[model samples]
Target chain A: MTPRRSERSGPTMHDVARSAGVSQATVSLVLNDVEGSRVSAETRARVLAAVAQLGYRVNSAAKSLREGHSRLLGFIGDNVASTPFAGEIIEGAQDRAWADGHLMLIVNTGGDRDLEERGIDSLLSRQVDGIVYAAMYHRRLKVPAALREVPTVVLNAETEDGSLPAVVPDEYAGGRAATRHLIDHGHERIAFININTLESGLPAVVERERGFVDAIEDAGLKLDRTLVKRGDGDAETAYRHAARLLDRKRRPTAIFCANDRTAWGAYQAAADLGLRIPDDVSVIGFDNQTLIAAHLRPGLTTMALPFAEMGRRGVARLLAGGSGAGVDAVECPLVERGSVGDR
Target chain B: MTPRRSERSGPTMHDVARSAGVSQATVSLVLNDVEGSRVSAETRARVLAAVAQLGYRVNSAAKSLREGHSRLLGFIGDNVASTPFAGEIIEGAQDRAWADGHLMLIVNTGGDRDLEERGIDSLLSRQVDGIVYAAMYHRRLKVPAALREVPTVVLNAETEDGSLPAVVPDEYAGGRAATRHLIDHGHERIAFININTLESGLPAVVERERGFVDAIEDAGLKLDRTLVKRGDGDAETAYRHAARLLDRKRRPTAIFCANDRTAWGAYQAAADLGLRIPDDVSVIGFDNQTLIAAHLRPGLTTMALPFAEMGRRGVARLLAGGSGAGVDAVECPLVERGSVGDR
Candidate 1:
């Protein structure tokens, strides 16, 4: 009998009850807390001791299924396969979620309708408390209809009609601050270079471009059409655009890049044209991507998008049930480096 | 009858069955796939049509509890919360996992015992099929004992005792290749600068140092201890360490950095001392970190560790149910840039 007992695996509720001299129902009541029937403290302690000694384990999956909520939150990124920016957002969201006793279930949607819809369905089926839809940029988005029923927050992007609650940087302020910084340093004849995207619509891009133009107008500087170029949101495009600007008879004293990558392209074009930074043509960029800005020859002077902060606050808002109708914006600050100098 | 129907708000299986003209049992059979019960193609099609029309949803939590395994894989990254390198690894792992019909559950342990243990426990509770533990670097590791029961593969970190499986870059080969590149260019004297971490045991460092020493020893050249410096794995530390090396009476004709970041530090130190890259002294580094290397005055010539490939393969190995007890060393290739020049 002893040898057979040793050969048997870990004990279950039945074994615990039998050893404790109680009914299995009582043990179940004590473990599951059946409100109607209560067990004595002595009996409960004995059952617990037997269970501990026998190494009884509760099946978490069974418990979760019964509880209806899995204590899991999901994050669906539009396209994390291309950019490192979304990674910071994930880190921020994960950190906050982990601290609150929840695990983050993440999926990269690859911007596919089927994949995005499937991801939302899976997260919902898993009974996630909330879902976070994060995009690489603030694009006018057409969210999957399935997710409309679930509690979701859009990060770094806004709703098409501004109905969904979203969190994004105050790009207009960031642009204004960068231009102001350049203007205060006694530089005029500034040009704005940007990428043409639906997200970079006449609204977002124009907001930044307008901020730059406004600063120039306010400073009483002449605004020239030849200086304002569209980079198509890429390095090669920005490089060509910057090359065209620099090759013209009268180059603008300064150029404001839409983003850091484009600014890097402008820097390369400037370098290729034998113009020195600050001395030949001052360059300013947005988004202080540390990896790029730090290593650039003179380093890039740009604004730092509050990616981590936005992610952190976005998670906080989602957890606090801050879902209603409308979008929220955050402000990004300018980071001064060597790329901008006095005229 | 129509007015009475208003009292019943929730959907029922009969409604779905009626909508598709299928029997309740057939609908259940198609939707739940009750084991051993096969439904005809016509019945399955009808059930699916009914489901789509009525927006029928299955309770995945209950199903997963019954099935004992969720279509989810867990990845525990070593401090992904603070670094970008881990981001690349995660993106690679997630993309591969997504293609294989599995969702990735990411847990950032932040290099803590309790957190690491909780991360694994959370995965187990979710009933994930396998886990991938990705560390930031290849070095000795202390994997939690509780994880031995679950199938797991380590990435970017090798086993302390080689018995555990790991996938890391071939550092020895990388070191030899870097030294050979410098040597082939007719550099007689060379120096190696590295970072100091407890996990980076003498064996791995010695392997690289041996490669550098061997390249010099084979050529009957003197290996100066004064030129060999350790950066302690940071820009400030590497800056100071390289500064000391440059201050020496007899400096090596060229210096090899242990990693790209450390190399960036060395490059800064060289610039501060007015030593032109490849003109006064040639410099080479390992780990082609694009953010750091691409922006250097002379782009860094270094080896690109196959982190993405390792990530892809690590997930694949876990999904294939391979025992986590083997080593898979990936090759690191050299990326030519302006940092290293022919002496």
Candidate 2:
């Protein structure tokens, strides 16, 4: 537990104080810039000059002890820091934290309960000002008991007990927006390619489906039950469903894919069947993952999840002392590209 | 500068010591399990029982002060923590650090020089045991002056001065491997879609191209300059180049794409030309980005960048006192899928 010197051996505060001809206490007060201190401006200047000359940097550990806060926020997520879409959540939170003069201490647990517990302990031991507990996808989870002792906000997820503040994408609104966009394009017969809830009971699946039905009914269009198909939210499954739907005797003029990956499969189905996009069939997608949506032959028009916004909001909530014990649904904006056209 | 109480008050160390009928110092030694401490087993048991009953957590700041080292590794990267491929580097470094009883303190700079300087200052001030300076891609960079004060290892990058230890992908070896895979498939007439160094003078571009030429010549095939085309390392540009090659009178039976995104474009071109993958024309790609590679109709056969491995190696070097200097070229293993077939 002994203090080890850095390899390069930078000048210490004591050396700076000695050079400035001031007591170490005066140097500490001048360097920390403590408010309402009785030190004269000349003394402060002398200490500052000595610090610059000696290249003396404040020891953050000692500073943290004196301030009682580390000016650091802990961000713990389950498989969010490394994944494609979820990584944006970390970026959003980090940017927001940095803007507030706080740096994020990130720990990605990849959904290991043991690691998650250890990560929480590590963050708590480090005395992070607050914690942002996040999930890769929108879902309900039970947070660890240790988090109750710290100011905590959940991102892209909600506490099962609903005792903590949370921010998640407005899946219902996103679904409504996607359907309404297709309707505005003059498409009456719109088929829905939904994520299979049986395989993954995600809240997004049920909420988005509800929004789709509500939009169709609101538009005075007859909702055909047979027009809706459920897939495993993957390309191969969506391809088979799209191929069948497009080949039907009474084919829908448009298809609303649950996600970008699903839309990718639909694109291939239309391509293989010699059906031109927007001209022969209009398609819309959700989760505008730029990697796929932007690069498709004709760019895909899809709904963009507010991952970054959710992250920012989560950190903001923590900074505000983790107030408001309820789930806050952020709006998902529609990103229009080359995929949609007049039906 | 005063210590602020957490929202939910937790039992402090003093409270545990009081309940255990022991001095605070005895509790500290028992809890920290300091090596060769003179605490009897009975006293340790009593202290642990009190800790469990009171739910007391150690103050990490105080522990860090006692131990000289924070037991934390600082990871400062230029847009690596939130990107697709680069995020893996963080994961690799984090996993390795955790295995050695260290947690990574990650800071993503997004290539802002000011932020990079501030991030390094923050890490140094916090007294991180070491640092991992990383770049989003393989390239050479000048590290900050502050980095000299600590043990630093560059990940997926190298220092301009070559004074710090670094780990980057073996771009030349990857390129050679990609070409050899195609040649092994009995491809005589092969073409290469290379990254345009005019737009991005990345190390991968030059090294990979060299490896491609070397592999072709080593296989006793006639090197054709006309077969090599350059693009912006994107799907659209690669699409145009691939379409032209496919339409030529003496088209190549196989093509090697510099990256997966470029290969995705080539896939579309071949499909549009009614050429089935691996059946009619073969294709290979570099940087096996699973988001594209695994989801493509037929999985892509490509070279996988050793991003995660580089991260692990970088952290390992830092843990080993950052002893080695010069660059360590990690091998990019070939991931064989359904893309390549016999010509």
Candidate 3:
């Protein structure tokens, strides 16, 4: 273990005392703000001035030990620090935590069970005021048993048994909203390129598909099961599926893709078939990943995942003594760009 | 301010002592592992078993106060947690810190000076072993004066006056490699779509452009000033520029884009003009952002910015008592996908 370097370089209380021509004990009293220090006002001012000149800072570790509060929150996530889609989650949680005068100790465990246990142990050892256990995506998970020792809230995910407060994106509502937008655009024969659910069985895949079906039926349009193709939520897979659908003689007027990457594939498929977006074939997507959606030839219209809002709400819930056992679903707003068109 | 909740719920030392049939003082002595304590080996084993059964963790705050080491590293960044391109940087730093039995306390200030100062103050008060001050993109910056009080290293950026150690990407080499790859493929007339340097004057723009010019000169090929067009590093701007170039009577066979986004624009321009990528026009880019580069129809061939490596080296430098005032440039590896084709 490396010895702490602060002791070697940081100015000590003795340095402040010498600069102020005061006793070390008196300097400590002034710096620590001891309630009943008897130092004169002028001497206290001089000591503070010396401390500032020397750039001396109070050691919060000692203060936390005395107050029984570290004023630090621990954030443990499987891949929040590494995944491109979840950086906003950390940003929101950090912003809110800072607003409350607390800092976050973050650990990205990469979904390793042993690392997760170690991360929890580290956070517990530090005496963090609370823990925000987050997932990179919306899923059901069993939180570590150790998290029960502190105020914990799940973010972007839910506890398996629904025994913990969680903040997740309103996938069903988002799906419904996405389909409704297409219907609103007068796209009757819409093809839904759904994400594959055979392997992951993600809640997002099921809820969004359900919303697509409900919206089509509500609009009095006959559901064409053949038009719905399963993709792996990737560009290549979606591209192949999109090509097959668009190549048909009688194809849907619009395609509702599972996500932005899928939308990208559909865009390529349209290009290959000499179809202009929103003019020849309208396209919509979920998870408005700005990198792809905003930059596409015709910007993709999609549902924005409320990742940042979910993160902020997660921290807020943890700070508010944690809410009752249930999931708090945040709304995923529709971001309109150039892709959606009137059919 | 909200009080810390650990005191209300966490198991106490008294609880451990009661469970082990030992005194509170004895439990503290055993848990703290005080040097030369008189506790018998049998009693120590019993106390350890009870601690394990009750999941009683040692309070690191108290331990830090006693040992003068918090075993924590502070990571301060402008937009790391919010930007898509920089998540891997955080992952690298956090992984290294954790491997050394340390946790990272992260604060993303969103480039607010006031927030930056407060973040440094918070880390100082918490007695972090060291700090890694980072920028979202590679640039020259003046680190906060408060950072002088601790061991600090800059990541993905350099100090304006070269007064601190830093790790930045080798932009020049990456640019050279990108241009050389095209030249090697027997492309003589290559148009360079460079990022606009007048606005941001980013080092990456200047360095990458220099590398492009050097490679052209080194290969004994005349540098065509007319082939270089300035772009705002966005897809729209690149599209307009690429369209004009590709529409010319005698246009360059290959286009070297400053970055992946710029390349994305070039791709669109080619598609609109009825030109196939690498078939009608060979294209290359820099900063292989996986979101764009990997998902492009023909995966984009580009030089990847060594972001994660820079982050890892930054923490490693800070841990090794920091280095002399200079910048350590890490290599940007070339990632070959399907965008580039034989000329």
Candidate 4:
């Protein structure tokens, strides 16, 4: 017969017990740091010394069984590993879970449906008390069939059905604030560069556009239909669109980019046309992607995605005995930097 | 008495037992996917059907107890989440662990020594089979006191005492390759932009410089001491250094930047002096940070850090019954893009 893993490995609790002249149970109590055990101080110290000498590691599975809870929280994400700047969600969730005396079991599915389903099963079989489903970009997602079997919350994205509890950024508020910030800087003619949301049906795009329009109309400013445009939400595409707008006979004094990368393209366009930033044309962006935003000659003024807060709140709600069916929105705060200038 | 979590949350295996008119143990056998069980097909189907009706979730701790392994690996890191482009390490480790039927319990300590200690304790209490300690930047670190108890491997960094198994990138080899690539393109008079490592004592800086010097000397090229300049490893500082080099009576035809960001600074300096990239001066960088390298107009030619490979190998070494006391260096492959040009 094949020997079990424990038998094949190095020293065990039994070895420590033999060395310390105590029962294996006593060795376990001391190694596990169990509370209120009746073992004498000297005996506990002897067992600990034996453990240190023998390098005895308590088998986690057995310990979990004895304790009745694994104290592990499952964190499942699609494409999070490949997505840049979105890692803070995992960090925040892990930090909060650790503070609450739980470990985060992270599973990056890489957007594979089969792998995602299998990941959930594995976490469940490992007995994670709850699961946090996350996405790199905010959008509606199909619910995993196995997710309902445990306490689950969605992060950065939500189910189209709205059946599961979710924590996400308030995109509309961020858009309105960005537009308002631009207006407050004495910019009347403002152009809005939007994302090509027809392909993905992302609510952020549509809602942010609505906020832009509301801000414009609320200020009694005429909505210039010709000023609004859509791009692939990439720098290259944003550059082309920005150049066209700048080359036109009439140009806006300020522009609001859907995200920071787009704003970078707009910056490139301004450079190409020999137009100085803010002096030639002011710009505001969203998502505050620091690689682009912070490093730009004049830093970008934009809204920060509440990824950390969402992760923190998601874990908090899970520990609060939530039923896994609701949506809580986190506010995106504005970061003032060199990109924005007063007219 | 207060009801157990399973009793309060939803259906229990006992509910399936009663509905199917079979023993709860039989239900567990079928649902836990236990191997070598001899339950009849009819009874197994009935138990599964009843489980679906009652939504019975299998308790993982009990299953782990029966199997005698938690099948969980702990991943502890400092500043990994906040760092740009380091998520690949976690991805590779998580993917490998999952394929081996193991879960990775991740904890980001953000360089807090006390928090690091507590995080390790938490993972151990959850019963992780082994631990993988990682860092954002490759450097020597003080090992956590709790780590010696279990099978542990260091990723992207090594312990100061050299007592732990470690997997890290071959920065020296990478520097050689980057410099060689420049020579292969028929470039002479290559200048190496070194990082300011006076205070940090970072091995990457010292080793990379050695590789650059060795490659230049092996090519029978006289090394010019004036061509070597140190920067703060930022784009701004790099730009200043690059400008000074270009302003000299004789400028090197090509430049090797300490990193992608430094290369970006070089590119900007080239533009400021009305010099076109490759046409006037070819540039190569280290660390193919896609945000800066790939997104640049010419696309940077640089070396890729073997983060994913290191993460994968670290876990594999632990499972291979390693004693956790050696360093395994992974290769840093060169990524050739548009920046390199034939002289």
lDDT of 2 by residue, B188-222 (tens): 89899997763476888988998999999999999
Off by over 4 Å in 4: A1-68, A197-200, B1-4, B8-58
By DockQ, the better pick of 3 and 4 is: 3
Which candidate number maximizes DockQ? 3
* Angstrom error at residue B121, model 1: 3.1
Cα lDDT of model 4 by residue, B204-311, tens digit: 798888899999999998999899988978888999999999878899999999888889889888877878788888999998787778777678899988777888
Model 3, runs deviating above 4 Å: A1-54, A198-200, B1-47, B198-200
Residue-wise C-alpha lDDT for candidate 3, range A225-292, written one tens digit per residue: 99988998899999999999999999889999989999999999998898889998999999988988
Candidate with top lDDT is 3
Taking all chains together, the TM-score of candidate 4 against the true structure is: 0.89
Clashes of each: 0, 0, 0, 2
**Deviation in angstroms for A319 in model 4?**
1.3
Name the lDDT value of residue A250 in candidate 3: 93
| Ranking according to DockQ, highest score first | 3, 2, 4, 1
Using all chains and alpha carbons, the TM-scores for the candidates as numbered come to 0.79, 0.96, 0.92, 0.89
Query: In CAPRI terms, where does candidate 1 land?
Result: acceptable
